[model samples]
Target chain A: DVKVTQSSRYLVKRTGEKVFLECVQDMDHENMFWYRQDPGLGLRLIYFSYDVKMKEKGDIPEGYSVSREKKERFSLILESASTNQTSMYLCASSLTGTSGYNEQFFGPGTRLTVL
Target chain B: AQSVAQPEDQVNVAEGNPLTVKCTYSVSGNPYLFWYVQYPNRGLQFLLKYITGDNLVKGSYGFEAEFNKSQTSFHLKKPSALVSDSALYFCAVRDTGTGGFKTIFGAGTRLFVKA
Candidate 1:
């Protein structure tokens, strides 16, 4: 079965601390995405990587950065955690194609709480 | 650019009854639409997707969605609702014509299945 694994299911960080959320997919998909989900606002994309070392900013990329050093691993970085940054982070991966296109497979998610 | 909208913020249904969650989308050309379900504290799960051909798409957990090109709507439905079926349902869209496959998700609709 295709699996997307997140490094943390729950995380707690103090304001101003650096935070790292990691995601790895076993599917070897070329496209990986990071999103933060909040009530009512839904899931807002933070960053995405289409290939190794290639990243693109999403709709809501403020205060967040991403790294894709490896093809299977995508990382979301919070340079300095803030109280408002507390939310559920989701990671997803999809293949690279044009015939039928690819659908995203999401990880279990990481709920981050910054106090 | 592609955009999705889930007009209803919440939908309430009694257990064992059929339920429908509405979703509409706008894109320049043909659209690749998707439906996902999110349980509390869990990440989004792929329910189903509509690429082409058949308008009705069946997915996991007895869920299905119908794609209507005339109305530009994709509504998710189930024959019967279980307590486990209650979740936050999201509708997403991505343009397959030109731009990269960057999915845009709707605001999401919370479904409550009551006994």
Candidate 2:
């Protein structure tokens, strides 16, 4: 079975503070993603990395950045935490293939609260 | 652009009754649809997917989805409902013909099963 793990399950930060959320997948997948889930908005992609040292912006990537220094680890960085950034953060990974029909395995989300 | 829509915000059903969660999608080309379930404080778990071939695709935990090309829908269904099945459900889609790794998710539907 594939397993994805996050660094923190719950976090609280003050406004304008830098926050880091880490994700690691044991399946050695080539694609990793970061998303913020909110009520009524669902899951909006923040950023994704297809390979080590490669990153791409998603629908809502503002005020967020990503790092993929290694294949197993992907980190989401909040430049300056704001109240609007308070939400559940999810990470997912999938194997690379010709068809983009691969199932993405997810981690047990990180709920961040910005004060 | 590809997009997915979950018409219902929530669905309530009694145990042993049939349950259905509606999901519709739009894409310029061939679509790769998927269904996922999320428990409280957990990330989304892959339930099933529709790539090609069979219109009715069976998935995990007795869940299944039927793909309707004319209607552009991929609705998730189950024979009977259980209290353990209560969770948030999301539908996702990606344009395989467009050749991008981005997958768009619906707003999500909360399933409530009463014993």
Candidate 3:
């Protein structure tokens, strides 16, 4: 089975603290994405990496950053955690081309709470 | 600009009743539409997608969606709703203008299936 595993299922952090949420996919997909899910707002994309060391900002990338040093792993970084940043973070991976062939496989998600 | 809309914030249905979750999208170029389900405390899972040929797309968990190109809608449907099917549903459309790597998601609709 294509698997995407997150480093933490739940995380709590203090305001102004630096946080890292890791994600790894066994599928070796070429594209990876990070998103934050909030009530009523649904899922908002934060960042997308099409290849190693390449990234694109999504609709809501203001308070987040991402790193993809390797093909199977992607990491999300919160430079300065704020109470408003507390939300469900999700990571997903998909195959190379975007021509309707990409089916994103997602991790279980990391529920982060900023205190 | 590309966008997705799930007009209803919540949908209530009884067990064994047919359920429909409405979705509409606006995007430049051909629209690659998708539907996802998120269970409590879990990440979103791809339910179905509409790319080309057939208008009706069958997906996992006895769910399906019909693609209406002329109407710019792709609504999710299930013949017999199960109590376990209660969850959050999201609609997404791939942004071709943004190189098709970014997917715009709807605000999501909470599904409540009463026994």
Best by DockQ: 2
Which sequence of candidate numbers ranks them by TM-score, best first?
2, 3, 1
- Tens-digit lDDT string for candidate 1 (A13-98): 99999999999999889999999988899889899888899998888899999999999999999999999999999999999776
Query: Candidate 2: deviation at residue A23, Å?
Result: 0.6
List the DockQ of the predictions in order. Answer: 0.72, 0.77, 0.75
| Candidate 1 root-mean-square deviation in Å | 1.5
Q: Per-prediction interface RMSD? A: 1.4, 1.1, 1.4
Candidate with the greatest lDDT versus the true structure: 2
lDDT of 2 by residue, A1-115 (tens): 9999999999999999999999999988999999999999999999988899999898899999999999999999999999999999999999877664488899999999999
Q: TM-scores of the first chain across all predictions?
A: 0.97, 0.97, 0.95
Reference-based lDDT, residue A104, model 1? 91
- Model 1: share of native contacts present? 0.68
User: Which runs of model 2 end up more than 4 angstroms from their true locations?
Assistant: B95-98
Could you give the DockQ of candidate 1? 0.72
Residue-by-residue lDDT tens digits, candidate 3, A3-59: 999999999999999999999999778999999888888888899998899889988
| Candidate 2 lDDT over residue span B84-109, tens digit each | 99999999987454346678889999
Give all candidates' CA lDDT scores. Answer: 0.91, 0.92, 0.91
